[model samples]
Target chain A: MTDTRNLGSQTSLPTKKLKFHKPKIGTAIFLTVWSIYVLIPFVIMFNIATMTPHEALQPFAFGWDEGIQFKAFSELFVDLCMGFTIFGAFLNTLMYSIPPVFIGITVGTMAAYAQSKLTWHGRDFTFGYLMFCWLMPDCVGMGAGYMWFDFLGWTGTPLPFMIPGMFCGVAQVFFLKSFMSTIPNDLLAAAKVDGLGDVMVFWKIVFPLTLPAYWCQIIFAFIGAYNNYLGPLIYLEDPATYSLQLALRFFSVFNKDNKPAVMAGNILAVIPLLIVYLCFQDFILKGINMGSGLKL
Target chain B: MEAENVEALEGVQAEIVERQRKRRKTVKIIKQDIIGWLMGGWPFIGAMIFGFIPSIIGYVLPFMELHTFDYSQMEFVGFKNFEWLLFNERSMFWLALKNSLYYTVSVPIYLGIALFVAVQLDKHIKGTGAFRVIMFLPTFVSSVAMSIFWQFMFDKTGGFNSILGLFGVAPIDFLDDELWFMPSVIFTGTWGACANSVLFQAALANVDISMKEAARIDGATERQTFWKITFPMISPTTFFQMLTSLVGALQVFTSLQLMARTDTGPNGAAVSVVLYMYNMAYQWTGPDYGLGMAGACGLMYQTVLVILTLIIFKTKKRWVHDND
Candidate 1:
């Protein structure tokens, strides 16, 4: 969001030789078609989300001719939110989401610091461990993970989702490690010379610098935690603890005939993600660039 | 003789002092290792429980007959569950295995589409930022939301067919029909191509313009210049993106699950291995084909993935440009 045109402009340097870099008519047409194709789903979602059931049933039809407006959303928040309101579900999701992301990133950054910035004997061995674990396919351990969580009495709670995340995946560590490599060794060495310890080095120096890199993963991990369906679906049995996804799933299951309300729920579920993205998109691009060792 | 004895004593004393200093250095290295492990390695506690242990169990559990979480009822089943997969007609494993394999391998087709778009946007454009955002908008939305959107669109009389009806064409059943299942998955994925294209964008930005400029001036066509100059630089990104996309697509759940009511699409066409296993783990009412059966299926799929991953990494030298 912060920058864009200068990015794509880099490769086409020869075009800069001219005063007018006339965008091809063909390109404009192609972009317009592509944009429409991409935007159609969003358009349909919004249009249908706001529509009355009758209006929604007619796919391309648009009319406010009958029934009260925003009725579907009202019913959604009122009659059919399954034990949790959309807001409650949102709160439940946040409760389930934030701790792990906060803990994970902190631990991940610290670990990444250890991997890339510090000197240690087992650094390369730990790197190998992270790579091996990162490549491990998930869900095969469904029985074991479930049994383990049950054994710990963590199945119904957020612990299953939260605690496991603190370790962070190889992807997060790898990206952060790559970004941290760009951190000059002498910079940390100089900090050490000034009597900064590992914790202090992380707090006062590395954290602020790595914020750009962390932002990318933070958004990804946060959205991932929020949008996680299977974990919540399996673990949380009580209606009181249903996340937005669970709430939506139940609502849609019983209320499939109420298409607009379901769509409204879907719309509400997506808003937080959209806000997170709109706010942090620049960081995502910048972070990816910096993380991947691009010219930052 | 007294002078010689004093010199020898000094030499021995120096050696002892040197040994102490070396021990101190080793101690310091060990201290750093402890600190590093505390910071980074502690998370492996959770990884061990949630990741490693389960993976180990994943391999071993397939050999057992403890269907439910009641580990007390465990029994050795050997290759019986694996045999059931091959022999049983009721087993959804066949179609599911076919679907997952095709879905995972078809990544290059969708990736090529994203790369094509990335290439288009890179050609000296201005004010294309809005388009970039629109393209990427779907990735930002939760997959559940995106899945719901696609679900409605692919509904028999939903948006896609409605649009088709306007063109004097027969309305197509994008969801219920098995033939359009993979196409629907690929089509739905195109909205999120913005996610895949971002890396390519970075790769293109990093491409050295001077090399391309040199080739262009020497009568190389745009396509020729791309192949010779721009492509070699971006192939690494392509390789990395492809690997991640394959892994991610293999675990396809929330999206495909949402698109169809049965959550597997028509005849399990959109059903991925993870979803298929999920049914066994929970939904499928079989004390017979419970979590143990799912484990066997999951173990098989994971082994294939691990093998595929190794093959890809081994063959990296073939495709990935070694500019570094």
Candidate 2:
């Protein structure tokens, strides 16, 4: 494991060890204020989520007065003539998001494995083409995608959102390719010599070796899919098919009278991602470092 | 004589086995090549269909005067769409373009704040890890959620204004006022500044400690040591961060869309180019497909501009230190 706790201590200076160095008072004060600024929204969101609507409208105060109204959390599950419940939107989000990420990872890994390990005609050309495509602004393709989807009568369906994701994601492919490149070609050659098929070699050797890359891609894919508002907004007209983002937006807009419920829904929308980030913070940080380092 | 013959026979058999193994290896190589093709081909086809083909279509779209997705109806209009976008009295394109470019001002602000905090955290202060997590927490939240949360905070009777009221100042209409709208957007834009700082922190950590020690031993103060040694060492990372952040800022849509709530806020003051494109394509009064396509073409030009800027910046690699 990286010495994340002692990041500054990696220096060779014996006298300037991180553990021994006392941080200046100015630095401490700045960090404290910054942290408060960063965290206050979340604290207030949760705090307001536990309050009644009337109390929520009041200037932000901490703690529960009437024993933390769990009503909004429960009420989110109960459909309020808003065409769909929060639970249903969550499920729709999962349905729309999961398949694409699954396909993206699989296709991205396969392509990366091929580009990194296997020799094939046009491999370099294909890699270059994909990189170019990746660098192109998303808007460049989005208009055409909208037209294409409309042409195909796939506009109202989840096909528009899922189909693109089922393809190789550029970032995932690049990250995994770089990771896979680090694994010696000799190991793969040995595996082939052992009578293992290409698929078996990938599953047994290459895939296992690139688990960190996969973890990073998976987390990113999940977050991207979950937080996707633009996709669902453009594609889906049915409220039942709306992702949590759309649903939350709709709820907040129409149900302006209920602040606590809106806050509760916001918290619900945020918690899963928060948990994923908290759990895999190390991998995420390492992945970012690896990405930046690769650019360098 | 019989023993010698037996040894020669065994040698012949061993050679035959080795030749067979070599033949099998060549066949396996062919098979692996086929597998590689199959593995790479699927995504290549997908990219062609979804990525390249659509981009080409989008590029061609602005030149055509088509009301709908029907290609049969498309009339080649030449530079008319471009002319309309540039010179038309009703076009919001210029305003959107200006606002979008203005949004990039936040990139340096974000980077500066992030770098400062990162330097502070790099000092190995107590509970820096906790501070790091707290700071980065906002980044993981959805843009919509963050916008909504900020909407509450920026409300006239909201917590932010209430606090200002305590200080005997009039409540600022952050979202409503044209003057304050961009600032509000920029302020909310900085909520996830810590994400960049995390990357900066990592870069700072990986800076050559020996150089820092040399500077310190030579009587360089902490600030000087940082400015002279550490900053130059991490300039490459700073460049990367700035590039990505600029790209992201130019594509600023979600926060503006959600915060502004409807129609780009107070005479389109907060209208980003992407948001403008989205509205043109999806939510405009008549859904002018040509105009939408023109907006997309505009976005492409902006992207090209960004890439060119990046290429220019990349030429400054002479200033970037390679620690390795």
lDDT (0-100) at residue B242 of candidate 1? 82
lDDT of all the models against the reference?
A: 0.76, 0.79
Misplaced by over 4 Å in model 2 are: A1-23, A58-67, A290-292, B1-30, B68-73, B287-307, B310-314, B322-324
The pairs that clash in candidate 1 are: none
Tens-place lDDT digits, model 1, residues B179-230: 9877887778777775666668778988877676666544556788788668
Model 2 Cα RMSD, 1 decimal:
6.0
For all candidates, state DockQ relative to the true structure: 0.37, 0.36
Q: Compare the candidates by lDDT and give the number of the best one.
A: 2
Model 2 lDDT per residue over A78-181, tens place: 88898988888999999989888988888898889989887877888888888876665566545667876777789888888888888867778888888888
Q: Which portions of model 1 miss their true places by more than 4 Å?
A: A1-23, A79-81, A294-296, B1-23, B167-172
> Which 10-residue window in model 1 chain A sums to the lowest lDDT?
A1-10
**On residues B239-306, what C-alpha lDDT tens digit does candidate 2 reach at each position?**
77777677778888887889895687987897887887777766764535444454445555556666
**What DockQ would candidate 2 receive versus the native complex?**
0.36
